[model samples]
Target: MNVNRRLNVSEVGDVTVVRFVDRRILDEANIQEMGQELFQLVEEQGKKQILLNFAGVEFLSSAALGKLITLDKRVKSHSGKLILSNIRPEIYEVFKITRLNTTLDIKDDEADALAAFAALQAT
Candidate 1:
């Protein structure tokens, strides 16, 4: 897949780790591009396991959250898995408030997220 300016995509074994470079995903254009890139990775690149590393991200708009939900559904439909990691507590609290925390697979770090994917593979 092509490189995305908004996202830094990498591979860890069988898992594709996507890191968001933009701190605030609030704009429509950037959000759409981010979602499309993620979809392409799954549909074209056949990435079944994904880890979204939010180490530098500090803000996410509601629209951005919607994009994430859409991406999560796409991954699940393909029988794939998506895990989120390194989300700042404030940003994570948004998920909790929206009750998306229950639906999304969130972890504390990339290593933990990778481990979770490995555990899923073992099951």
Candidate 2:
């Protein structure tokens, strides 16, 4: 496993599980670093399945959201899948308000996200 400053990365089967290092994802520099790291997972590291567990995050800035959008696109462009799980209600509200809920695959928990991944493979 490689070192990550903004994310805690692990693997469950073929799925790459990524947890945020910060509770609030608002800092510009950290967000930038985080974005690069995320992009590298698909662009450079060849990760095909990514699960972003937002269990520790309480807030995220628009810039952070932008990075997520970009990450999702990059992952898809690689024929990979991205799933978000364990989002707090407030943060989920933000996604809903932004209509990102429709654009991204989200689940109530890591288990559900993993199940979704398994379902995809089964198909």
Largest lDDT belongs to which candidate?
2
* 25-83 per-residue lDDT for model 1 (tens digits): 89899999999998988888889999999999979999999989999999999999999
Measured by TM-score, the strongest candidate is 2
At residue 33, candidate 2 shows an lDDT of 96
For model 2, the superposed segments whose C-alpha errors exceed 4 Å read: none
* lDDT value for model 1: 0.93
RMSD for each of the candidates = 0.9, 0.8
Cα error of candidate 1 at position 113, Å? 0.4
Error of 2 at 58 (Å): 0.8
Q: In model 1, which runs have C-alpha deviations exceeding 4 angstroms?
A: none
For model 2, the local distance difference test gives 0.96
Error of 1 at 38 (Å): 0.9
